[model samples]
Target: MDLDSLTLAYAYGCRNAGDFAINEGSLALLDRTVPDVDVTAVSRFASESPEYERMVEELDGVEDGALVGGPITYDPESQSRPAQLAALARNGLQYGVDVAGVADDLSVHSALYEGITDADAMLFNGGNAIHYSPSHGNLPYLLAMLYPLQVARRNDVPYGLLPQTTFALEGVARRLVVPLLEDAEFVMTRDAITFDYLSEFGLSTQLINGVDTAFLNGTPTAGDPSDGESNRIAAVPRFSTLGDTGELDAAGKRMEDTFLTYLDRLVDAGDEVTLTIQTEIDAAWAERNRDRLDDIGVGYYESYDPDELRAHYAEMDLLVTMRLHAAIFALSVGTPTIGVYRPEWGPKMDGTFRTLDIAEYAIPWDGATVETLEAATADALDEGRALSQHVADNVSLRNEALVSDLRTALSTADGFA
Candidate 1:
């Protein structure tokens, strides 16, 4: 089969620089496998936002593309209850209208529906799309994705769910997500946990164990062990509602206290601690904790360029981060990372760490203490070179498997070789 003649609609493309890195890496892999294939990105944001504009810039020269206005607005936490309800109602109505063939060309819904209908194949980008226990407030965001997915299935357009993480699903979300997974031409999960979770759903679709596509971000540049004038450690912070049940906030307070104590230990030890922000949400957290972080003399880094970000990670001797991509960036470049994991953050961190044979470096958020963090940091530094080589080898092996699985999925879908 001539793959150049095929057109693939890539969905869930985002503005987050880390996400862009994954999409860019995935596209590069796809291009190498099947040269000159036409690809169009279907974003989850409207064209007017900076998110969409950034996506356009990143996708420039890749292939032809269109907007298809995203169903959910950014920052759902900030929107009023009535406003959220109205947006949900609007999307629900629009999807119904489009499915009924009553949508006019001028309507955004019509354009979105048409993008899927016109595609020869659909590729959902890698991310945490499944929720294990979504609050009532989170249901709408999950529903927003269903319309496009259902449309693709209804139209008989072959679709694949790329490397993704699934936490827990229940109630309405489980009902909708299970059917969607069942309909996918193939499903590639980033970790064993997610693959096992989806397997329980009894979906007939072929499932493949895959690593994060971001591993294709290229080979790691070895860092010099002797050049360490200062013990540079990159620490990433996250803003989480870990225990917001409208009751006692002890869990939240404990998480913050532990994190600060960990940072304080590093600073007191004469290490040059830097707080790196991966997403806008992380930026907001950093700003809110500015005074606290400032008192400890921690530096800040805020950038959207993945190459620049990876370069920053490369300079660090060790990375202590709550963000998955930050850990990935560090590992990709031979810098050992200590991951902080919380139940609310899902399984990506633990999964990725385990996949790379570095689970010993992971610290559970609730169980974290200054002593534990300090010990982990020391261990990472002592074994840095060995750990780095282990990660590099594992990443290379997984990347090969990922590309192979992708090829098999595409060939199976095309019904030709």
Candidate 2:
């Protein structure tokens, strides 16, 4: 039962909030299910700046893992980047970096299949697909950058994708990833467009729509639901992409203007309007949004520990978000969530908003005119409370099932080697 005997690897955009949610979710799941295993986390993408330094530091002590760099840069012409990733992968495998915490019994583990078992239950944890932004190339080390996933597959190791978005493969890139998806144990995207695109490409994947990992346990507001005084909706301003140079401050200003306009139209609309901040790597962005708020809001879970964060989500009456994890946290409390889908990277919208029963709640990223957003918001506010209750009753059970599937995937009895 030594907590430091198991090992694992993850892929993430540490800059994004979803990465934080995924890590914390895995940790919670681990602590509850896995009796005694040391978890190792390695950050894939990083820079030499102080902010980057803070990020890596924040992820401290979570995993007994190593963080290695990749040489394969995303731009197809950046030959050095890919080569570096390949070298890192080879070096890591050669050095047995992934086997750092397998206790004495499973120390020699290195195969794909051979699922483990403890007592009568199978240990369902193994090499997992780092669910993240396909738009962000630096972290993943590019398409087909490493064959470990393939290796894990060959060994019969189960691969579970933690709430990932999608990218439409075109030309040679598309040609390469099809077979990879074909072999994945399970692939769940964050939006419908991604689900549809991957399906169009012939990957018959399940479409179990859910919010970001961050939403696993967000809080709710307590302004007295009995009085109907706090019947309001919440939203995060839209900003940033995995590979964009857009100024978040400017985006914040635009959100402020848009929010005010959105509110003016709802002067007597029964729902109070408010704003919250969801950050990826941009602290400045969250701060900018906070500055623009009406001196009071919920869903601002920054700089808070997981317990406090969960409490914050419990306080919300209704939640709407541009950030994926924000949706998850709200959903964790059975709060109705609206997921925004921008059009430029239409594929990124794959799983988040492509969900059935909630299609009317989705705001098309490219088509978010105030009128449409307001109209949708108005309708959602009317239906939201009941929707939240329904999710708390129905959807929460489905969420538990996903966790069960994950547990089955991570059974830890025998050797994965």
Candidate 3:
């Protein structure tokens, strides 16, 4: 079949710069392997982004559609939590959390629904679209993300997923989503942990081990280093220290204090430090810690454009970030990056670092100290050149494999080649 004749429906929701980077990378991958293809992006907030508008017109004529019949509520004691846990436990989820809000129905945007049903093929772009969260079981979020793909499935249209992170899944949630995943023509996971998680399902789809596509979307630029002076550093902090409840509990307070103390030390050492905000979540955390940040007197860099954000990372001599994509952008451009992460999300960060054989640089936020941060940051700076080359080579190799696999998947999709 002629590639140009293909109408590829790309489903994504941009909530952060990482989301934008993933979308950019998805488009780049398609451009490389399926040039001139007709692409339509399905986003609920299409009106908010020109990039989304350029690919597909703003969403209109949305319909209130119900997929399942049940009560929807946030109360963990509701029948939904236990039922979901029981289902997932049978499928291999050992210990599941019950914080995710329940959703019995989906508000279907007409454009997204029709885009999948009428398109020649569809692909769900990457992120943590399918995952179990400790704070929220993610059932409602999962339904919203899966609604488009479900439409494609019901219409007998072929679909696939790009590289995505998978944290957790269980009972009712697993039962509802796993079948669709198993039936995909192709599915690629962004990390080994996710790949292994999916392996337990014994999916018939061709499962490919892939890296985050955002690594491919970056344009590396080597910045000038400080000549024997304090290094220029950019830190992208997340609200993970506060846990899912968003309350400043004892442990959470300790983590936050350690982080702030580390920053204070950085400032004391005369390093040209700056706070970088890559998402609304990061912005909120900054606001929460406004007084602390002000006392430290560090500068701030904020932007929503993926490429612009990448350029910002490229300019930094060293990047200390809790945001996964911030580290991704910095490493792609050869900047030394130290990832500060919590266990709930650390697996994904560690998986990315492991790809480049730099897992040591991904630090655990729990029991972390100013000394640990200093040690990791110092080590990363010392091995900057080697780390950069390692990342570049690994990303190049993975990107080639991704494109080849995507080409094969597209060629073999039902009613395609």
Write the candidate numbers in order of decreasing TM-score: 1, 3, 2
Answer with 1 or 2, whichever has the higher TM-score. Answer: 1
The TM-score between candidate 2 and the true structure equals: 0.64
What lDDT tens digits, residue by residue, belong to model 3 across residues 1-417? Answer: 544433333433344777667766776787787876766655534333443443243122112220111112222223487765664453221111111211214432344555555567778778767765545546655665666567667667778888878766777778778888987888888877788878888888888888787887775544456576787889987765322345555765677788889989989988889899988777888998899899997889987667777788787778998888888888777777888777776367877777667777888877479999998878767766666666656666777888888888788766456
TM-scores for all candidates: the values are 0.89, 0.64, 0.80
lDDT, residue 108, model 3: 29
Off by over 4 Å in 2: 1-7, 11-15, 30-38, 45-160, 188-232, 242-244, 247-257, 263-273, 280-307, 345-350, 353-356, 408-417
Per-prediction CA RMSD (Å): 3.1, 7.8, 8.1
Decide which is better by TM-score, 1 or 3.
Answer: 1
Tens digits of lDDT, candidate 2, 13-89: 44555545675665555565564654443333323333335546665436322332321123322237767677557
Model 2 lDDT, full chain set: 0.47
